[model samples]
Target: MQFTSEVIIATYNKPDYLRLCLKSIAEQSQRPTSICLADDGSDARIDPVIEAFREAHPDLPLRRSWHEDQGFRKSVALNRAIAGSTCDYLVFLDDDVILHPEALARHFSCATRGRYLTGSLIRLDADLTGRLLEAQSYGWAEGRLAGWTPKGRSQWLKSMPFPSGVMALFDRLSPVAPNFQGACASVWRDDVLRVNGFEGNMSYGGLDKEIGVRLRNAGIRGRHVRYTAPAYHLDHGRSYADQKVKSANRAYILALRKSGETRAVNGIAELDAV
Candidate 1:
């Protein structure tokens, strides 16, 4: 049976990256039911880009849920998208990550009812990222053939042929860990709501893992899909990453883990209450 899923691309003001991301999604073999742009207070420049994308992909249902430019409130923007989405499943992606054509298909095939899937991305160098952004074609082969380096573990799985059964075996044997990466991940909407969504207080760094910790505390397991549903992450300087804020967020998450905290203080409930 097929499940209804939506792709939520959390983005700021990078229209160049967003354009490539949207194009990749549009080229997916197993397209999502809809695509939602979870804009975290970007400027007016993003308006025409999104409109053009929507107009070009007339068959794809594209919508935006935006908030005022109130700093890096990605957690809040994602919560807004979750609240607005009508799909049963959600595939989360950052604007800079360009997915493989089979990325969604792989995710859908591996999706489990009671668990969330955490995937990985190969980081593309600045030079390649620039070339891809300039080119209109969403050809992932160009990057792969050009030898983009995989950033994390299990990236070698990208080259493996489908139906290898390695992913299933890995999921069964792997231990549940708090490595929730928001770059390329998919989860059931109900499961996310159960943990009250991501902590709104988090600044950067450990925010994604914080949600994973809460999910684990709530008895929701995370399946490692790192190699199975891989994407290419564009390399760019992180202007929002503050080391002090990241350290604080990490400390908060560690404390929650030790205390066995299952729900976030500022999360979906607060959003719903508003």
Candidate 2:
């Protein structure tokens, strides 16, 4: 099935990056039915940036919403955005990232049942060193990775880089595998709602990993879109990136472990909020 819409859920305090992010979407080979950006309440300047994009792309369906800048609970804001969209598939991305013209098309092609698709994020150290891209420019595009790339070299151009076969093998063996990452992922709306949408309680990080585990527990298998669909990550020094290693975020994983509930791939729960 070809979905006419793709939702790119993003949140950031930086206005400049948000502007470029919107522009990149406008350039997609297959334009989204609607581009919705959920801002986790940012500085006053952020509003104008969003407004400017909206004005320039008046013909393109775009929606924007915000929550008061309270604690940096990305999960809650993400849920808010997801609940607001009616797209057949949702694509979550970071604010500073840029997509290749065919990024959306590649993800659409990789859609498969019981498979939660994952894509690599190419990071360029120099471009992101100063927070936002120096000139709203994308670095380079990487098809895939043999292993996880650090924050710096995620976007370096590479031809046919392989993925970590060990990681793939381990995922196939483990009951719960790591498959979810925001850089580039495509999931059905029903599958996402089945897990209650990102565990709004997770304060800073680990929400994506925990959700992937929950999906696995729910019987959905992991799928990697490596070498097929690639994206570029503009480097920024956000604390959330480093928070993956923080012990506090690990608590979110423990919460999932305690649930003992598995989501079956063949079914979906009706979300009243959705």
Candidate 3:
């Protein structure tokens, strides 16, 4: 069965970043059925920003909604957007990232018989240069390979083999994989709803980790699109970095593991529960 997914771009106060993100989405080789802008209660600035874009691209399938400031619980904002939409698949992205030209087409093309499909991100500096390349150029981190493309750069990727012991260790560490960024991923609409959207408690950190865990618990296999359909993350000040915030994220993960509650977040049910 073939289906088209609506790309959801979640934004907050960063109007400049929002414009860039939307521009990238606008130039996609295969445009999404619609672009849903889910704002996490921002100041009046966002309205003008969105309106400007809307005026520029009158035919663009752009939708907008805003909610009150909900602390660090971005999951709540995401769920709110999901509940407000009607699409076969959901493509999730952060506001500070730019998609490759074929991002949406590749994601939907490969989303078969799985609950989730995750792509890798190339972490670029604020200036949009390759960090690894910079390290090699400055003779900081010695490199064995001349030009190694990190996972999720494009559709073509090379395979490398490691020892069985190392592979076993890697499998054990699946729950805490370092590259579990949900910014460049997609999920079946039904599968996401079945899992009850995201855990409302995990607002700031660990929200991505917790949602990934739940998907795994529900027997949803994750397909990594490393070196394929890569998105670029625009680096900025890590405002979400705080000791207290990380602790709260860790506690939430522990609770998710202990409770073992796995269910879909249906839109109607979400409204009724709230």
Query: Per-prediction TM-score, please?
Result: 0.91, 0.77, 0.76
A best-first ranking of the candidates according to their TM-score comes to 1, 2, 3
* lDDT of the structure predicted as candidate 2: 0.65
Instruction: Please write out the lDDT profile of model 1 over residues 59-120, one tens digit for every residue.
Output: 99999999888888999999999989999999999999888777789789878888888876
Order the candidate numbers by lDDT, best to worst.
Answer: 1, 3, 2
Q: How many clashes show up per model? A: 0, 8, 17
- Name model 2 segments beyond 4 Å from true: 127-132, 138-178, 239-245, 254-259, 262-274
Report lDDT (CA) for all predictions: 0.82, 0.65, 0.66
Cα lDDT, model 2, residue 123: 62
Q: Candidate 1: misplaced stretches above 4 Å?
A: 142-155, 158-178, 272-274
TM-score of model 2 vs. true structure: 0.77
